[model samples]
Target: MSQPPITPVTTPPPDKGGDDMATLAKGGRTNTLGFILRLLGGLPFLFVGFRLYGVDEMGRFAAAFVVIEIFALICALGEKRGLAQRLTEGIETDEDTPANLVFDAMLVSLVVSGLACLLLITFPAIIFPNGTGSDFDMWMIAAIPAFALTEILLAAQAYRYDIATTVRARAVVEPWVKSIGITAFFFIPALAGGGIALAFLAAIYAALLTALYSFLRTYGLPKAWRPRPRYLSKMTSRALPLIGADVIERGTRLLDVFLLGQFTSAGTVGIYWFAKEVVSLPQKLKTSFEPILAPVITKNLKTGNMDAIASQVRQVGFWIIALQAGIALTLAIPGEAVMGLGGPEIVGGTGALAILLAAEVIASMAVVSESVLVYIARKRNLAISVGVITLQGTLSVGFILLVQHWGYPEGFQAAGAAAALFVALGVASLVKSLVLKTLLKAPVSNWRWPLVWAAAPAVIVGFIFTEFTPEWVEIIIGGPAIFAAYFWVIWKYGFDEADKVLFRKNVAPIDSDLNASN
Candidate 1:
């Protein structure tokens, strides 16, 4: 039997201009909405877990959760961003429909997830050495297909510029289901112990259903779909570099947990997990941007529009850094109080929380830079990611061992690990930004002294509040006050027309004002 001829995919000429502004506006709005929903839906679960189940049980759940997430990342096969890039290419050239692209990704994801599941089942000890028990470990494996499928579905919608679908499934459906399920299950003595893991599995399945429904509603069902070896090879080959980068990128988060499991106690791991979870909230913004940014970057790359690409990277990088910096300041200002809310046992992780938040702030540049480089310099990008993770792993283990050698208390181990993470991430971000800057010959960071000026006053105010006021009072009064001060300074002196355009419905007036001011 003869194979179908492959349709040649061609790139469309770039728009004259204005595309970056439009994409940023739409992406920013949707991502912001998603971020808020995630915060609302997700935080409740952490509070419930810490308040009800305490640190140890949550630690057990955290252990299993890490394994499940690592496998999910593996099964995702980098399709989250890679699929967006491929879909953009197909749509631009009319080589394939959305259904075709989604179907291809789904098929690959299913196979990879299946393989991963089998491997986990075969060597459960290798992945979960502390052991989440056989039943919980099985549940972890069961969630992989759902996890992988949801990612692909959401990426498919993102390719269509329908980020709201991702927001709905991930932000609204998944987190709420988990939060509610975990709360309800805690009431039953039989199910109370593993409620977190159970709720997590339930949430993934719910998200999978939601994603499938949304994807089909938007793209319709696949037609005349048949698996082709050649097509699979092409897709996998294109996705391989991304798979390496994505796994290593995500593995950075899991590395501390894995190493801590080996070198520290479960209770300490739980405290660190809680702190990591809280600090990681801002990271949702970066993930939100990637889906939308991938297509824009891919389109620009196709047209050889390096200038537009750099401009987009710089703008988005600054946007992420600005927001993350504010969030970090807010969280880290009342760091102990923030952790206290989780539970008394976890409050000791305040130092870790502060350090991890700093890591997120520094990582903004690396995240946005890698997004652009992955398309243009796939090999180099992968190399950088590998280097970053290698450095992170080395620093993490070394710092952990040093703390032990110094006879520091176990409670301080997490902070030591977090400090190592900060150093490793700082090094990685600096190097990655330089590489992107050299490659593009344009600025990859839009940050200026004005941002620093804005941050200084906010930090000072936060410090004063922390020293004098109660935890609740500081959080209630200081958090918003700091953010307002930061934004006020930014608006008064730092924000340019492009930044203002993110807020305005129409860019023409802002553009005019910018010209007149100039």
Candidate 2:
């Protein structure tokens, strides 16, 4: 008996543009649930780390992790978005399978990541600009390979429209493991100093394993797979713009932490990092669409279906903005209460929390637009990303120095960084959307008046809770009340017939034959 020939992941027929919407909705619904679970899982780590390890130690951990994550992104080489194009083009040999292409990416990632790990391990200071707690801190560099590989594997799964695997690995497995591992490691007196690093290592590797298992199951073993040096070199060269774009876009978020660690005290960095984590919940909503959107856009581009592509950009853009706006309102309105959840010492970051949440909401268009731009105009997109990050760096430093000159505290400096991010992202969103609109020759703006209507009521609801109720009540009651008010308005007034598909329980299934055959 012989094994079956390998094929790309199953997707709905390209002709039914409606089916594409259905696929997008399914992914969005699944990841929306993941965001909730991730919120639950992530909060524990923040509480435990802030309460037990204290701000200085966690700040050190955040500083180091930022460096490692950036390096990991570089090693992954932008496969998260780029791989969908590779798969869609089927540019490799007819005998070569999707799994083979993935393996080639994995091989390249491993080589680059291995080199990164060695470099970081040697310098160590690059990872920990603010000195290390223990020699075990160097071991955190091990996360680079795992993190990079997990990115590629998860991208492979997303190509197949299997976002549940992503939800499981990222939302369910990674955070919970770190939460549990951090709590567990803290109990051992000797390990307590390095608990955050150890827990992060554990989390990254666990997610890697989860993603690996899913990749093998879905893509199967690559047949006749061999490394082709010339081919891989071409692939890597082509990926340079995407790699730059991914790093620069991600760098905008991490640069503040990196710069803050250089200028501010560890405690200040800790406060800002906590606010960033809280804002990340809404940030994840935009990403929920990225993996799904990539393959959809690639397919549409294949047929020169500019209308379908534009429609998707609008549809997904609205979905992300609507959800992010609701989350931003709920979180930002009671910013102090949310930051207070970390610890009383962390409450000073309330302004930063609000600003970061607003940044996530405003950055929605840039993220969505980039999803298309990466495939169509990657170099131009990369150039714009570079400009945005440069602006963010300039503004962050200037604002921080201005606050210091004005005799404000370090917490105000942290808020200054968040403010810079808000402005830079607003610039990125405006420029990127305009560029995308020009190329697509269609309207791609996600702004709708209902968003204003929804947010206005939610803000009032949140104001009443914050003004009249206890801090605990404001958090416990106000959060839900604000969300209810925001989404209720969005549901009644914002959602049109097509938009409602995101919430529909029984979307017509993809063809069963496609499922079984794949």
Candidate 3:
């Protein structure tokens, strides 16, 4: 049978540059709020899990989590950014809507996730390479489907410029559930051993439910939707580059843990994983711009508005670098105090924590550049991603082995892994940003002298507290002082009226145009 001719959905008219900035700012503001909430909510779980569960158990959990998240990202098929491009390009028929398309991605993800669960179930050793703390550890793979589906649903909402939904699900519901669940489950004698893993499962499902509610509210049910295997195969094939990019990009973060689980002890992995988690808070600032950047960039691409894409990328890149730099300095300067909060045992990871925080700051440019490159230069972007993760993996292993050969402690090994990440990410940022600038035919560097100006006072303030004051004072009073000093300089020198848009609360709401047809 012959298929009907496919027609592209007519694109919406481009909004003024100001409106685009407003949309990006709105997303930044919402996710920035989410970042704070995530920090507050996530810290409790870290504290309780380390102090209550102990480093060895948490280390095992961290190893398993690395596997779970990697597989989950694979199952998601890169819809985190790809879905926005798909929706922006439009569906094939009148009967098929964005809801139907989302369902397509979800259905595929579920099938893959089920297979993944079965594979892990057949060989539980893959997840617990060292050993399991409790019998219930095997069930953690069940969260894979929920985690994958949540990514799709959240990406769908982001297509409508609905970042608040992501904020609510990821920042508010997810972390709090895990934190509370970990604490609650700890008290039950039967569940205490596996409470951390159980809490993680609960959090994944909670966030999925939260995302589904908002998705249905916005997109409703699919209208006359039906499965198409041929179309699905095509969709999956088209997403290969994106999938590889997403997996490899995330792999760099987890590869260190996986390698360490083999080369070092479980407790060492726990300390290193704690540092990764702490640095992830600032890392979220870059990703907060990604979902929203996709739709805006795709819309501009459809119209040949390369300049608009370049401008948006620069704007978002600066915002991320500035915010991440300040946060990194504040945390890394008082690194020992922050790491000690998890427990004194965790204080050994202070060096790793400082290096990982710096890595996040440097990676911001690569992150923002990839947002544009994924659309205009998918293969090239994927190539760069592949290259960097390979470099990161090699360096991580080499560093760990060298440190071991030198008779260094496990803490030094962990810091070695972090230093590897720092080098790889700095290389990635420089190369990726250059590629993006070349492709866009415009200057795309995010660096500004004001960043140095902003950091100088922050460094001075942070050094004062670290040298003169107590740990509590450094964390409580000095952290804020560092932030204030950095941002004050940023506001006075770095920000123009456009950059100030991120601070404004009264911008017009960014709404969906998904239901439009032309």
- Most TM-score-accurate candidate: 2
CA lDDT, every prediction?
A: 0.79, 0.89, 0.87
**Hey, what RMSD does candidate 1 come out at?**
4.8
- In model 3, residue pairs whose N, Cα or C atoms come closer than 3 Å (at least 3 residues apart or on different chains), thus clashing, are none
Model 1 Cα displacement at 151 (Å)? 1.1
In model 1, pairs of residues that clash are none
Q: Give the 10-residue window scoring lowest on summed lDDT in candidate 1.
A: 509-518
lDDT of 1 by residue, 254-280 (tens): 788877877777777889998988876
Better of 1 and 3 by lDDT: 3
- Per-residue CA lDDT of candidate 2, range 288-405, in tens? 9888888888878877888778888888899999999999999999888888888888989999998898899999999999999998998899999999999999999999889989
Residue 214 error, candidate 1, Å: 1.4
What ordering of candidates by TM-score runs from best to worst?
2, 3, 1
RMSD of 2: 4.0
Model 3 lDDT-worst window of ten: 509-518
Clashes in model 2: which pairs?
none
What does the lDDT read for residue 24 in candidate 1? 63
lDDT of 1: 0.79
lDDT tens digits by residue: candidate 3, 162-227: 899999899999999999999999999999888998999999999999999888777778878888
